[model samples]
Target: LWWCPTGLLTLLPLHAAGYPDPADTPAGRTVLDRVVSSYTPTLRALARARKADAPATADRRLLAVSLPEPPPGGVALSPLPGARAEAAFFERAMPGSHTLRVGDAATHATVTADLRTHAYAHFACHGSQDVNDPSTGALYLWDKPLTVLDVAELDLAHAELAYLSACHTAVGGATLPDEAIHLAAALQLAGYRHVIATLWTVGDRTAVDVATSVYTSLVDGAGLDLADTAHVLHRTVRALRDADPRDPTRWAPYIHSGA
Candidate 1:
């Protein structure tokens, strides 16, 4: 098999029907054919050249665990209070029914909690990708120190949506399990309906602001047909981009989504 990074990026966009779902057209097939053709050669060459073993993603099937029933003390969903008094203009735009978990920085609890229950989950934290050691790429919670250990244990099956709302958790490693962006792949493998992650860093304030707007729109029922968190995140981030294109902080976090 051959490997071509260009295909997943360019072909998917040129042929996609929309976010979370790409078009499976002749063009799409061509892209896929190339990816299939490229894989074997890419792997063999990389292994031979680098002399480094790649991570295992042999279980190509997405984790299809049935959604776990809400257990006792399932989730503690709450909005960031007091801070609301000082909410940026973006905060006021938030509508009702947006079940968010807010803290000084509660990324870990929020993620762990969201995995256990809920149709939608949002997070604003610091995340990084590891091109060299794909498994080490991880998210940095506002409150907790994020590591691969945490993500490895997450039950992603119940999570219909996961919005990383931070920098580059979307990128996939080169190998099957090695997509440098393990977060998205892992979420897909764990059976999440959708996982939305970023490819680069964003300003903390900007991230919170974008998340505020998008989740607000979602809670108001704008994403009725949206199948993936990436769609919601894309909409939100794009709005921010339009609001201020010059803000490198806004555009840097490219989407690495699995829908």
Candidate 2:
């Protein structure tokens, strides 16, 4: 598991914090080079969050949200043109899932209510991380933001996985990293078994590719085992890393948490 140090340590990659390669081979070159890493806000939270295992594939139901436009009075966030594409990809990739896209159709009330019934969820939109109070962090919905505090108030007993294709959903406060105050952790606290989140602002197009690869692997039985999601992510990220080894920013920001 990974835990980034709060405060000045945010610049470091705690998950990839090891030393030189082992003499034997390339296995231990770095913490990231070998490990199938996962992140958590705190050790206790991690333990609590793993109380339940991910549900079976047959039982999975997805709720996908994609907001390409910034809300009224909110500055343009470089329109995530890929958001619609991501949603459509999932609808076809994971057939029989519910999708709430840009329009008068997806609202804060509808999205939150849908959370309780769905086993999995995906969000492709702009995200805001509240530096002073990480708990106030949120992912933009059609009408408003689904704040971390708001997520914590829900009881999602059937929730199995959540993929936040937005920015900084996994980032915690620089002062209190162990407090588990961000949106990803808040979803865990609300009973989600697994969450895939970003550590910082990520490339919009890259985010879509990662999400596509992940869901496709999870649904296509011929691909990697969905039961071993960490391994699935490891392979996916490694492929992305191999494509452009120089840009760690693209692949490194996405991390899986929980079982």
Candidate 3:
């Protein structure tokens, strides 16, 4: 399912809408158990992503950016101690195909520069959504925040997946509810074929678990394939839901956007 929600509907998790009664059969329980869901800012954006050329297998590179500790002299942001572990997991999982930019190394400048060369990016840090002005929403880095406007301005040809294991990366602006202006949408506009993001605040430990499960299913002898992202995410989320059916907030917040 490709959702193109407008106005306040953009803020809702349409993909996760369904009854979760234990008595119901698996297929009838929730949307998570049914079809794979993806969101698009518009139909045109979906078309553009579909038209994008797939990067060569040999050219596939992963950029893992983690900020476990906040840099000094900045607006205080909570430390994501699990981010370092997440990046390290990626390094071990992808081996030579991954680059680690942890702590002081994960600056806005370096991340943007690395995004150009990498086919995939995994940001394990703090994300802030400016509800009043979504374009100002950003992923907090070492030197500064990588805002929605910054990502929207990029034109990456080889971009594939951007796994934003940060909080509220998909929340749209309250002032312009119909605009679909958020970090996830901005990344799609920037030429990433797919993006994995969160609609609300997520626990650091849960982020690690979700990333680990998703990547474990994605990586194989043939390597990661962007085409299977939605399906893999669907399965991972289903497993999470099954583990804790009472807390929809834990599993339902994670969403896939783009092709």
RMSD of each predicted structure: 13.0, 3.5, 1.6
Alpha-carbon deviation at 134 in model 1, angstroms? 1.9
lDDT of 2 at 94: 59
TM-score of each: 0.52, 0.86, 0.95
Each model's number of backbone clashes?
A: 20, 1, 0
lDDT of 1 at 172: 52
Q: For residues 1-259, could you state the per-residue lDDT of candidate 3 as single tens digits?
A: 9999888888898899987665444455577767889999889989999899988887588899998997667688888889988988977888888889998998889999999998889999999987887888899988889999899889999898899999999999775552689999999988999999999999999999999989998886435776789888888888888788888889999999988
Query: Which stretches of model 1 miss by more than 4 angstroms?
Result: 1-114, 142-144, 173-177, 220-249
Which scores greater on TM-score, model 2 or model 3?
3
Overall lDDT per candidate, in order of appearance: 0.43, 0.74, 0.88
Mind giving the per-residue lDDT tens digits that candidate 2 earns over 132-162?
A: 7777789877777899889989987767788
- The lDDT of model 2 is 0.74
Per-residue lDDT of candidate 1, residues 153-215 (tens digit): 775443445556545565555555454335655554444444555655555556556655554
Q: Which window of ten consecutive residues has the lowest lDDT sum in model 2?
A: 219-228
